[model samples]
Target chain A: MTEWEMVVGLEVHCELATATKLFCACPNAFGDEPNTNVCPVCLGLPGSLPVLNRHAVELAMRVGLALHCSVEPSIFHRKNYFYPDMPKDYQISQYDEPLNVGGRLDLPDGTRVGVTRAHLEEDTGKTTHVGGGGGRIHGADHSLVDYNRAGVPLVEIVSEPDIRSAEQAKAYVNELRAILVAIGASDARMEEGSLRIDANVSMRRAGAEVYGTRAEIKNLNSVRSLGRALEYEVRRQVGRLEAGEAVVQETRHWNEDEGRTSSMRSKEEAYDYRYFPEPDLVALAPSAEWLAGVRAVLPVLPSERRVDLARVAGVAETDAAVAAVVQQGLDGLVTAAVGAGADGRLALNRAANELAHATPPDAGAFAKVLRMEADGRLTATQAKGVLAELVSAGGDPEAIAAAKGFEALEGDVVAGAVDAAIAAHPGEWERYAGGEAKLAGFFVGKVMAATAGKADGKAVTALLRERLAGR
Target chain B: MALISRDDVAHVARLARLDLTEAELDQFAGQLAAVLEHAADVAALDTAGVPPTAHPFELVNVLRDDVAGPCLDRDEVLAMAPAAEDGRFRVPRILGEAP
Candidate 1:
């Protein structure tokens, strides 16, 4: 197989979580009664006009700032096209100018993908095609348009063609979603279509400068589908290239059920949108003071949080345990535990692994569990149990620990368990006395089992060594 | 300069779903060219420091509170549509895929 490289760029459209539609006062909600959210403005009645929503603009700016983009003077345009879903013949979108331009997102693997622009636009109404094969548009008998989502505010973030693989694309999207969520700009829910991805994929030989013809894969509603569709498209293009056929540039739709992309429309059939400046909406240029205020209010984002977590935990920046805690949104619990005097690494591990699913206990309770484990008041297994109970039912950690019978064994109790193990496993003990050092682990396991894991492993080892040394 | 030709008018009319006759296309072509000529007259002006204007007014950041106001009754809105089904506007069979 010849070496091939994939070049990918992503256009992510995230719906702003504003309370109303972009140009109208219709409630910007989803999954409500189909046509209940319709209004003259969103329905595009003849006399209706658009008034830019300030809250939507603020949300868009918050996204841009989070992505590290420059917020410039942007204007809306009428992208003239006709569709039944859009009662207006044209969509009100930003053309030559956009709210955000030229930002960069750094993936977890340290690949910097440049963002070309994040422009504001309106979402079209949904069309539920009926009597079709699987209800797809191609074989549908007819379709119904619900104008509820017609004027919902959207920010389309277009990335520079800098992604090298499907994994990087997924990482870029994950980081961007975190940023959007951190800044309270969008929920970024891919399942609900609040966040959608369109991937532009092409391939070339290794070290080639010019790219092969690219195919755009649309309607990648989830991150998993985004990566899978890009991979499938890249392989298809490489297969065509190796077969000595020229790849045709076209827009393709991802048939997720089939796990392949099918041609939607060719570039030859592309529409001439005839975009003209929207004469109703005026220029949107934020003053320096306003920009500063937005910047000041931005919450600490993921990248900064990662560094802070590593520093606070006294671990390497690439520590998987710390990274897992931060990625799972459990960094707050870990931070609170560390602040209340729990060992940072212990807190990170327990929160990331044990308390991952359960609700986190109070800060002081979590810290006490970690401290108890550290001070040898509880065995590691017993500490996890206490933490689990604390998560499932909020209470004093000590009371829960005692109630669960997780009390630490006294020294004599551990010694007695060690003697019992030695007496029961005479044959294994003989091998251990005959200079089989590996048998130490066997004895330790037996002692832990005998004591129900309440005895410390180190203490058990010491007692076993003392008792078996002379034999 | 003839900016709007008869063919151009016909193409735009088709896109706009406007079924115009040959005579109507020809008349509208000439009228659209006149309108373009007037726009060209404005383009020819010496406004070196002039900024591009999106609207007639010099307004920026005109916004409403995030609070949602009253929505029109669904039945009333659906009644205004040419055809209504299941409380939604019913159009002709859509031939192509969604944009």
Candidate 2:
């Protein structure tokens, strides 16, 4: 609890959303049947040639651009290692010549997490270390290997230890995940191991510039979990330092069940996996024509789009942020809304407040409905209704809402409905007149309920107050 | 490259998660040093201001309509799992946890 500062950085190994493995033609789909997606190139069969998946390169480039990193003519290198799952006995990864360097991830609070480097690599196959409740190598049983995920494309984003707290680390991951998924380079789903994280959490005396020995906590799968792991590690290190014990640098594993980090192993126990240039694969320093093609295809990044949303849509800063998170080209949505003759400010307000809060957890779906509603084919109420009707309907929202007759009613019709509700709710009406204006909401609800919410609530509220208060 | 101690080789290899024999570790110390020395060639490139490139494709958002796309069939995706119990990928019971 003392004033110790955390010097934290992160290494995020994101599985690119490439259809095929990083250096092979095998399908890169997650959750495939074990080993079924493997091919000669990925499985490392003798005499098989490996080719880079073009999508992997593009994805790494797009992410590089988004992070504001210089896209170098990066090259790949081979990292040799002997493990049960790594069939090649060496993983083909980038070392010195990474795709990006000096990039930054900007938080909502405007803190920039400096990017050390982002590199491309062919992922190693996964291994299940089977054994009794003991150490892995000393007393482990036979291991089962899954090559299905072996050749998946991966981009390892390494950040400078610029983070100061556990919360910032979490925000960094969340923001990075949002940006990556927004770029469409990856699904960025941690639940399914698409976005895997490892943190280098260290500490120093309250204002000391020198850092203490850091522990690397591995296999963090979620943003919240990453934050918790960092917090737990920080506390443990602080406790160790307080108890006159020095923190040793080592790799630790996050036990999600216990919400803490346990020592996986230490540097004293390691052996060399000599790294060298990969001979089988040709060096892929892209030509200018190719880089131009890739750059031309770059989507508007989340931050830039957010700024545009504020300037072009004339919405407040906070509202612009929500639309920018994963809806990368949300500026297009506003432009489209405006092109359809919808008021830009009104569309943004409705989309951010009403439509945003009501957005399905999946952002991609929310944007489509907003577009349809903004075009005036469907009303705001109809949009909400479509979301509800199609919650399990497995059909399109606009079509479903139209089928259910939930489109927005005009201003005068809403006023008439308000008149009718007053007559029907005489008891509530009496309460309002008898110094109980709090019942106003009840009457408004009655009108909405009578019309089945086809009326715009704002217009209905205005008309209700004008007629009911006799103004 | 000068020869490195087995201990140093072992230490670096361990950081990277490779269980190497003593001989392999020694061999790798030489190889790693040579690789690092070779990598110095990249630093020798003439003029600066060259941005390191990470990818080689159009960096646009491949936006898809947010309709629920088809997911893998439960039985089908799980069919390839080494072990599946109760609709999840089950591994050998892991011991010890974060304290």
| lDDT tens per residue, model 1, B1-99 | 699889989988987789999999989999999999988898778989997566888878876777787888988888887887776777777776666
Stretches of candidate 1 above 4 Å error? A268-271, A410-440, A458-471, B1-14, B17-48
For residues A313-373, could you state the per-residue lDDT of candidate 2 as single tens digits?
6665456444443253345655566565556675565455443433232334445566666
Q: What is the Cα-based TM-score of model 1?
A: 0.89
Q: Which pairs clash inside model 1?
A: none
Which lDDT values do the candidates have, in the order given? 0.86, 0.70
Q: Compare the candidates by DockQ and give the number of the best one.
A: 1
Model 1: per-residue lDDT, tens digit, A250-330? 889999999999998775343478788888788899999988888898998887787888888888766777667877888
Quote each prediction's TM-score.
0.89, 0.65
lDDT of 2 at B92: 50
TM-score of 2: 0.65
